[model samples]
Target: MTAPVVSAADLPRALLVGVDFGGKAFFDPSLDELALLAESAGDLPVAKLTAKRRSVDAALFVGSGKADEIKALVQLHAAQCVIFDQPLGPAQQRNLEKHLGVEVLDRTMLILEIFAARARSHEGKLQVELAKLQYLSTRLVRRWSHLERQRGGVGLRGGPGETQIELDRRMIAERIKAVKERLVKVKRQRGTQRKARERSGVLRVSLVGYTNAGKSTLFNALVKAHVYAADQLFATLDTTTRQLYLEEARARVSLSDTVGFIRDLPHALVNAFQATLQEAMEADVLLHVVDAASPTWFEQVREVQRVLADIGAAEVPQILVFNKQDLMDESLQPRTDEDFFELEPGRSVPRLFVSAMTGYGLPRLRQAIADCREAEGDGLINGDAFTTQPYSESDDQPVIP
Candidate 1:
């Protein structure tokens, strides 16, 4: 993982903890995600910890007793920051920091920081800033708590920045409104461009899936574009679209790779990035990328589905593209026959397994996309037709190939 872009003055030692909350029995992919977050924050995670709890403790997220244990570990490890895997309310976060005597941040803030840091384009930066403000607005009330205690140093007067928490929250709300206004204009311009593309009759295909599932790799391989591909989560924040042709159709297809999804993606982030994700919603076809070798592939699929449902993109026609098949054992059954049937029953959405590294199964994957285009052009129904009602709610479901 690349070192976080932190100034020397801001550099701090950190410890990352992934609280299982009785989920340790699962493969615990969030542990890897937290490690990446720690690296992106310019903190070296010298120690890592996990705990199982029935329910979150309101005051100290991991429970008061566990918070004390973490505090001791922080002291022993000389840690300056403690990163948590789940989203922590401002009060819970403040309580944890007070107990540990260190800075504390939840997964949402950590991701926002990374997005703010990685954003290079003007629009991308503005989107991230808007998201930060929206998230900050919700926490302003907690920032000024206990101000009546008269905790202060020299030159700290009762004026200027020492207003009540409610006042600060109102200011943040105003700022959030301003940011939304600016974003509205930005979203409008993006919509205009999308409309132009649609008028041109281009078949838009979006790469949608969990983070680090090799969307960019498959993108670069298929389109021959030099997009950065890394092992880190949320590596690609800005949406990149390229035009590609398959077979002799000479069809114009807008291929987009957007931000990846994760478990419990903050609601603030979902609302903030809705414009960006609208690209997926409006696409003619969606390439749902999956890491074939991951032990938690099924769970990752569910997580992505949850995000899609949250964003109202569940209705979009999706083609399952299981990537990184090269990492799977050769002895495993072929994806074309028994394995594919077992994984994707009834062909609810077209599914193909491919190894972006070895190029194995890619031909079939590409062929599937090509077939989808052909079928679409021929006025044949797709997964969209199954819109009568999804399998989850309906019994007489017809499968589409």
Candidate 2:
């Protein structure tokens, strides 16, 4: 299917704002990632404002002076909306919108909107809706500014003598409950399928990494199935599972492509997509893909680790497949394909280099995966739990710039 193209002039002009607290390596100083996120959400970033603040202001977040500067930028660029790189409280969002005279969105809301737009499957749509509702449930005071709080008086469809905000909140609560119930059914269905897979004694492997890290590409290469591989952030939100046969190990494993992670991923989305993420959590092994060409690859690795930890998949045995190797400059490439992941005295997670786009060094990656599966599979039949090593506790190797 051909992708839809959006005109720049038709997209809303977004003014981006970020506050650097200092000492955070994951923080994007240029707000480039935020710009990508805005673009992914169909917004045109017209201007950017970055400030170094010691702490967040209780009301304006960026303090009054910075807020005024942001306001000027918004007006100067004719921005229709303002986006904050950091998450904002409901009151802080309201206060910022009132001060800037434009719609304001936090990082969480931006991600939710992208999910809402890109989600295709029923489970994906429901997960996004649930996250959006959970997020908006707290911001009703800001959402219903025009509607009076205490308007209902016995004849209203909502309830007798009920405030509009209260009625909406109640409705949102009921919806949240209903969506959660539906999700529980989905989870059980997945669980049953997993049990069936277990009965068949198949090895399970999941693809996981930072957004746009070529996970889908690697997945397509491994399984030979087209699962919507794209260059844009969050191109795949739904989990796609296929069977991958490893020739070297002579084993057929269930491979799943999961949603890519991002920096400061919203907790609500994490909670909402728990069922979808179950593939990663319960997989026999995880293929932790990474963009070998990114300058900030080390930081991206840390961000993906954080999400894995949040999803309780930190201990999953991972084979770090550095993808897009063909795009990496030779001068900056790893001195050797060998990398470290010390699991124990004798155990280590193999780090392999591969170009998913061109199929370079895929044989070594496949061999490494087949070996890992052979090792991990031995423990599976005994009803034993196995842990995936992520990193060394005292790993002090200098990050290759």
Off by over 4 Å in 2: 1-5, 24-26, 155-159, 342-348, 377-401
- Superposed Cα deviation of residue 268, candidate 2 (Å): 0.4
Which residue pairs show backbone clashes in model 1?
Answer: none
Which TM-score value belongs to model 2? 0.90
In model 2, how large is the Cα lDDT of residue 160? 71
For model 2, residues 172-250, the per-residue Cα lDDT tens digits are 9999999999999999999999999888888888999999999999989888898898789999999999988899989
Cα lDDT tens digits, model 1, 1-401, are: 99877564566777787776675334363487678777875667778888888888889989988898899899998999998887798899988888899999877888888888888777777778878878887776466666534324333334444455645666677777887888788889889989998899778889999988999999888888988888887788888899888864556578898889877677877888877898988887888898877767778898888888888887677777878877876755342510221223444664566878888777766666676676662221244322222233244322211
Ten residues in sequence with the least summed lDDT for candidate 1: 335-344
Clashes of each: 0, 3
- TM-scores of all models? 0.82, 0.90
Q: How accurate locally is residue 25 in candidate 2, as Cα lDDT from 0 to 100?
A: 38
Most accurate candidate by lDDT: 2
